[model samples]
Target chain A: MELQQLDRYAKALIKEAGRKIRHSLTYELVIESKADANDLVTNMDKEIEQFFIEHIRKDYVGHAILGEEGFGDDLLSLNGYVWMLDPIDGTMNFIHQQRNFAISLGIFKDGIGVFGYIYDVMNDELYSAQKGHGAYLNDEPIPVLESTTISKAIIGMNASWVVPNRHIENEGLIRLVKDVRGIRSYGSAALELAYVSTGRIDAYMSMRLSPWDVAGGVVIAEEVGAVATNLKGQPLKFLGQDTFIVARKSLHDSLLANYITLK
Target chain B: MELQQLDRYAKALIKEAGRKIRHSLTYELVIESKADANDLVTNMDKEIEQFFIEHIRKDYVGHAILGEEGFGDDLLSLNGYVWMLDPIDGTMNFIHQQRNFAISLGIFKDGIGVFGYIYDVMNDELYSAQKGHGAYLNDEPIPVLESTTISKAIIGMNASWVVPNRHIENEGLIRLVKDVRGIRSYGSAALELAYVSTGRIDAYMSMRLSPWDVAGGVVIAEEVGAVATNLKGQPLKFLGQDTFIVARKSLHDSLLANYITLK
Candidate 1:
């Protein structure tokens, strides 16, 4: 497989998809309730996802698609070529803030990520990577992260971990929160994972995230020796939302070894 | 009482301060331990705050200054004209991410917020407002929010609220997390408030934030009939951190009346 060509084509397609989403932003778009009325999935999300499916079917007819808007096919295995899509990862931020949203796409063959791209639509930043090659942010090659202790690390975590959530215990999360240098909670998991890949924060954690949410990010993050794994310290399950942590390898081990109560 | 002049000067100063910060990002700078090594107070932060304090003192002498990094005056009461400043509101984001940081300043008199400014340093977008005048995103005037109902609103919240924090009860916050249309946590209070003022998110809820963090944001947010108060719907203290909510007036009232447990 020509990873360069795959990365280039994927990048273009992601940008075009982003443009389509941007066009819909000012069309007095009708937003509909999903999961619940307060939980939104805009017409734009469907439009963008369908757009990707249309193009991929025409070009990569052999591929399977997994998407956030449910516009793609069902798949039992990642045995063939598969493309995971989150047309607008931060849909809420997109609908409300019109910024901080992204177009995330990942290509895998036989369950291994071959090429991944995450485009920050508003700011025009493209973070892309191919297996074994270094990741690039807006065309500049991003280096692997240097080591830092947990005490000196800036940790990215949503406050939900500290509350009475169904996922992790609150006291454990609170202790981690106090032990870290500081904490940040950006609403988008994909972007936060990308941030971790680039060494912005030493770690990124969430109680729930889908495969599409972390697929592209995990591909890029792994190139920098960042561990994108579940709480059990094993590889991610590309099917459902699970408790996940993507961090510099050392930090990830230390966090799992010291904190993180699994009950 | 000349807002344009103050905004003009403030804009320029903010830009200059941001430039100094951007310049620092290019160097092989040392990350020394302040309160904590990872809890950084960079040279850039100190320099930027000093730059603003110097100019404000030279020009707006009668203006009492309250700032982060302790570079300003010792304040007993906020009775006279007060300029609350945070050279870089998301200092952790700056020290670690080099983005998501901003220069936030709010001007108040006799405890009434009069003007507010939040400049996204890397993005170069300045959100500003003067009392009685409509808020503006850069040069475009922002209108008051028109959305109603908790279900239709896009809310900004740190998910940690669901885990376990002391400011607001976990059960109450979890219910809130489920009630909002969506949630976001950008790690920067100033930008999030700017988004709230401009109607990006219908409301914003956080456990504790400093006066400088919300001072500028609340002033701009109120111009559009958005309310800024503690979760209990009480006035905000201009000294320390508190559980705060800033939202469209209707949404704010609904959340406070229907949800949000203070004890």
Candidate 2:
């Protein structure tokens, strides 16, 4: 299928999924934890994942799928048309606040991302991108990030990275927080990446994120002249959990060389 | 004047002021720094403060105001009807993102909070409270906060508190960030307080804020049974720059006893 057709279908499917989730907010939730107490997953998350899986399987049967909620196909490698999905990216926020969660989807043709979408469910804002056609927030085209140093740039980062954590050195993250113009934590990686695409924030970095968590955002960020890399200033592996940073080119390099130290 | 009358007037005035600020977003901004480079004051901030001063002086001539933009009265005592206004509570966010800033107003009579309103200008969310009456978010009555322990609560805190700041001990804040269910930094004090009032977040704390920043939020939060205090667990002085923490009764006490070390 063409990239434009795939992007159109992805947008429609995510919006429909968002509508279903919004209607489910009033019902009693069946909640469960994935990794630990703070790692939450709800029945609604599974339902949404299943919804996406059914739509994609029926419409694009040739495509392979990798999804967060175990509702999509198992894959050994990105050898063909693959769809990466995070059915509900911020499940903790979804369960606790009922806002700030998102549906993130990225389409890659033989490991090359062709389309991406991040839908802020409650706010009804859709951020999407097609390769070489540029990124957009809703219908408005997002501009490329302006040049700014770390001292003037606002970063989207969580406090979890600054305290004792397994992935990165805490001291470096602490100093980075103080050095930036400001730090913001919205608790949703997809939305944070979307913010970077729109220049609402200069950069977004997380200590550890899975392929689906960064897939949609990386595609969108790349279109707007931002670079995505792991803590060591290497390109994202798109394979599994790893330290990730999506920032403007110069700021990304400065953060990697000066502040971010991976443990 | 009656508290109801004052509340009505404050709501209308803030709505008008929000409209004006939103309209000014199209024009080129005249930005200047106050204390440091990150501390910004825009022409719109001054214009909005002037707008409030003019309306208050013309309509409620007997009332006094303490405004952030230095356009209102200055007094040592809060004896009569006094308005505490932060024309733009999150000025940095306003100048940069144009989204997260709010107009905060708290009306005091004889040194006690009588009416409060915090208007999220871009989102058009108005959080208001009249003393002895219930709090509201855009005419909908907000409920008193439900009980939650610190381990299960989400905190709205800035990163500045956790990294070598003057007000609170950095080590204490670092531990606190690790102890909470999660930490969020929205960069808007009024919106953070409003979130607590509406149960969107469980608590909000800041190491340093002026009276106008927390005044409107204090009254609204109080209506919902949340307590506001300094890090030392005393009532906020509402004088100049002071440390502030607003949370549920139990969480407030636990934070002071366990994590907060006043510097």
Candidate 2 lDDT at A147 equals: 79
lDDT for model 1: 0.81
TM-score of 2: 0.94
lDDT of 2 by residue, B1-263 (tens): 56567777888899999888776663433333223323333677888899899999999989999999898887788889899999999887886687889999999988899888999998899999988898998978998887889888899998777777777777887888877889999999999999899887888998789999999999999999999988788887677888889998778888888888887
Deviation from native of the Cα of residue A135 in model 2, angstroms: 0.7
lDDT value, residue A86 of candidate 1:
94
Q: List residue ranges in candidate 1 displaced over 4 A.
A: A26-41, A167-171, A237-243, A261-263, B27-41, B152-170, B237-243, B257-263
Writing each residue's lDDT as its tens digit, candidate 1 over A1-263 gives: 46566666778789898777665554434353323323333767787899899988997778899999898988888888899999989876776677777888888888999887888888888898898887989879888987889888888786656656667766777778777777776678888878988888899988788888889988999888899889878788687778799999889989987888777
Model 2 chain A worst lDDT window (10 residues): A29-38
Worst 10 residues of 1 chain A by lDDT: A32-41
Question: C-alpha displacement of B40 in model 2, angstroms?
Answer: 11
lDDT of 2 by residue, A1-263 (tens): 57667777888899999888877663333233323323323777788888888988999988988899877777878888888999999987886777888999989888888888999998899999888989998998988887789898999998878877888887887789888889999999999999888887999999889888889989999999999988888877677788889998879888888888787
